[model samples]
Target: MPTYKFKYFNARGFGEVSRLLFALAGQEYTDERFTQETWPAEKPNVLLGQMPVLEVDGAAYGQSSAIARFLARRFNFYGSGDIQALEVDQVLGVVQDIINAMIKAFYEKDEARKAQFMTENKEEKLPLYLGMLEKLLVKNGSTGFFVGKSITLADVTVFDICDKIQAMVDFDKFPQVKKCRESVASNPKVKKWVDTRPVTEN
Candidate 1:
């Protein structure tokens, strides 16, 4: 078996899904976490100077989505087959749309522009993407997952993003989406990790 090392910041940001994957799979890996103050000294050594990087048997790989997908595939968290994988990817894409909108709002410089960006995200982007997610969950039989009957990369990604945005977005109308998140959160392995993992404001 290849040894693994996952390097990311102390926060959940883009790194939590991969951590949840590790927990769900019961796979043991070195989780190397950094703080914002300590990141600069080590940033130069990281590939592309970005984090949530995974090292497999000493080989470094970057990109949060790529890293998460690779881990998901390795741990059987992707899906059963090609078609299911496509479905999982579709949900992942929608989650990315939400994350992108959040990122835009998070980085806006002008206060008024930032508020406008946040408003648009809350009023438009979230509803569209989250509604699509809820529909996908319902289409899959309302099993609290977007893919097959069990949890997949799609479910984990949705759960992670929803946890991040729950405070900012109203999920009362998206019951299925809430159920999907609850399903992941209530899982034995995932719950264990969440219970023990560092708490972050994000």
Candidate 2:
């Protein structure tokens, strides 16, 4: 079997999705976690001088998003048709945008600024992106799944983002997002993924 080694911060900041994909695909991987002290010195040897890089058969692959896309394609999780694949990619992008906005809020100077960002996040970006998700979901005739009416890379990516957000924000006010997350969160496979997954905390 080809060897798979994933190096990243001990946290799940960026590497979680690909790791979960590996699990769901029933693939064995070497999950190597590192801290700054180790990463700065260790990273130079890799392709991009970064962690979260995956080594498959001694070939290094950087960029978390690209790594995720590659892993999804390998595992049959990308989606079905061209349109479905397109929607999947677009949805992942939307989720990424929201996550980035929220992370910005998390790292700001004062509580007031952080709270302001959180408020703006809940009021603006959250609904803008998640509302779109709700519509696409309903358009897909969502029987509680995102694309192809089944589990796909998009659903996994969305679930992780939504779940991570729910941990920080009060998402109850956004029922569409809450419902969307619940749908994905409740899936047996996904529920198991969440249950066994490592928390992205220090």
Candidate 3:
């Protein structure tokens, strides 16, 4: 096995999914966390000047989604076949859209503008994306896993995103989605890590 080093900020942000993947896979890696003050000095050395870069045997890679997908494949969490993999990718895309909207709302400085974004997120964006996710979960037989009988990358992705969404919106209407989130969170490793992971404003 190659030496794995995951570099990211102290915050969970985009990197938590990758960390969760490692935990779920029972893979040991160096968790290299940086603070905002130290990031500027260290940024230039990163492959893409981005957080959540994964280094395998000293070779660096950037982009959180790609890194998560790579780790998913490495850990056999991607899926069984091409179609299943595509399904996982589709779920990942939807999760990314949700995160993007959340980030926009999170970073808005003005109270009124932030309120508007939050309202739109809670009222419009969350419902649409989450409703779609709920439908997909139902289509997959409501098994609590997004792709196959076992947990896949899609499940992991959804679990992380929904876990975040729960802070901003109640998922009571999307029972399937809520159930899926509970399923992932109930995993022994996932639960342990989530409970112990560093807390951040984001």
Candidate 4:
């Protein structure tokens, strides 16, 4: 077995997906969590000066989605074939788009512009993405999984993002999306982690 060390901040942010993947796979890895006070000292040593670096046998890799995909493939959380992989990637891309918009609004400096961005997000983008995801889940037979008959990286990724979104807005209108989120959370290992993991404000 490869020795694995994942470094990230105390918050779930981008690191949660990889952590969830590890838990779901029952993989043993060193989770190196930092705080704001500790991050600056450790930042320069990080592979890309970014949190959530996955070090495999002392070799460091950057990018959260890339790390998640690597773990997904290793643990069979990626789907069975090339087409399924593509479908998973497509969902991931859409999730990233949603995340990007949220991040932009989060960091916006102008108060009026921020409010505008947030309003547009709440009224438009959120529904648009949620509806699209709902359709994808339906297309996949609404098995509560995104791509295949079982859990995949796509399902976990979407679940994580939807959970975050739900913190800001209710997802009651998106029943399929709600079911998918519930299914991921209901996984034994994942539920354990969610119940016991360190709490953070992210």
Candidate 5:
């Protein structure tokens, strides 16, 4: 197979799932990271000048969520039945909202604003999203995953999100979230996946 070039950044943020997805699918590729200074010169050279773009035999496709969904459908992490597949997609959508809120607030930052954004995140958005996920988990029987029997795209991304928050999104009002997060985080493959991924400043 012709190898792909996955161009992202210094951290796991958007590119982590692409990495995990590729790994889980048993596909081979080069995972490349770039600093901000280098992007200006390098990005324009890519087919679309954007990323986490996946290049398959040198044809490029952009959009992180699109990449994730496409890869999931291809690899069977999307769930088995039609309804289950849609459920897998729905859960992923909800999880993406939480991911984006934090990315908007903290990831793309000037050095000075971290403290203030962290306060805003904990006090406002974090709890709301966490609570929603916990409730969804509880509603679904807290089944050690978001969808059906096997791990899906939602499971992979949520596992990544939970690990991202350990240093920050503490369990005060959101204690139930710990159960949902722990269920996936403890999966041996997922634990190893998160541990191996490169840390991004974002």
Candidate 6:
């Protein structure tokens, strides 16, 4: 087995999904978390000056999605075949859209612009992306998994994002999405991680 070390901030943000992937696969890795104060000094050594870098043995890789995908494909969390992999990628793209909007709003220095971003996300982007997710679930026969007949990286990724924005999304309106998240949450290994993992604000 390759030795793994996942480096990210102390917060869940971009790092959580990969961590969830590790948990779901029952894989072991070094989870290296840095704080605001420590991160600046470390940033220079990172290839992309980003968090969520995955170090296998000594070689480093960058990007949260890339790291997550590597682990997912390695652990068989990616869907079964080519088409299923496409489905998983589609959902991951949607997730990236949602997260991009959130990150944009989070770092906005202008107070009014920040509020507008937040408002637009709650009123617009959330509904749009959630609807897309709901439609994808329906496309997959509403089996509570995004692709194939079992949990994939897509499901876990959706669960992590939804859990973060639960307050904004109306689950009653998106029953399929709700069901999918619940299915992932109820997973034995996933539940253990959720129950035991460090509590963060996200």
Those runs of model 2 whose alpha carbons end farther than 4 Å from true positions after fitting are 110-112, 168-180, 186-193
Candidate 4 residues lying further than 4 Å off, grouped into runs, are none
**How far is each candidate from the true structure, as Cα RMSD in Å?**
1.0, 2.4, 1.3, 0.9, 3.1, 1.2
Q: Candidate order by lDDT, highest to lowest? A: 6, 1, 4, 3, 2, 5
Tens-place lDDT per residue, model 2, 1-202, is 7889988898877888887788778788888888877877886688887768999998989999999999999888888768888988988988889878988998998999999999898778877888777777777775566776666788778777875676555666555456666766677655786688666683
> Across residues 16-125, which tens digit of lDDT does each residue of candidate 6 receive?
99999999989999989999999999999998998789999889999988999999999998988888899999999999999899889989999999999999999999
Q: Per-residue lDDT tens digits of candidate 1, residues 1-202?
A: 9899999999898999999999999999999999989999999999889998999999999999999999999999999989999999999889888988999999999999999999998889999998999889888999888887899999999999988898777888999999988899999999999999988876
Residue 63 miss distance in model 6 (angstroms): 0.7
Lowest summed lDDT over 10 consecutive residues: which window, candidate 1? 163-172
Worst-scoring 10-residue span by lDDT in model 4: 162-171
Return whichever of 3 and 5 wins on TM-score: 3
Candidate 4 achieves a global lDDT of 0.91
- The TM-score obtained by model 3 is 0.95
- What TM-score do all the candidates reach, one by one? 0.97, 0.86, 0.95, 0.98, 0.82, 0.95
**lDDT agreement of model 2 with the native:** 0.79
- The lowest-lDDT stretch of 10 consecutive residues in candidate 5 is 172-181
Model 6, residue 153: displacement in angstroms?
1.0
Compared with the true structure, all predictions reach lDDT values of 0.92, 0.79, 0.90, 0.91, 0.74, 0.93
What number of clashing residue pairs does each candidate have, in the order they appear?
0, 0, 0, 0, 2, 0
Give the Cα-based TM-score of candidate 2 against the true structure: 0.86
- Colliding residue pairs in candidate 1: none
| Model 1 CA deviation exceeding 4 Å by range | none
Model 4 C-alpha lDDT per residue in residues 1-202, reported as the tens digit of each score? 7999999999999999999999999999999999999999999998899878999999999999899999999999999999999999989988988998898999999999999999988999988888889999999999988898889999999988977888665778888889899999999999999999998987
Better of 1 and 2 by TM-score: 1
- Give lDDT tens digits, candidate 5, residues 1-202: 6668788877787878877887777777878788888888888787667778887788888888888888888888888888887777777777777777777776756765776777777787777787777776666677767775557887777777776776767765554457656765676666776677665565
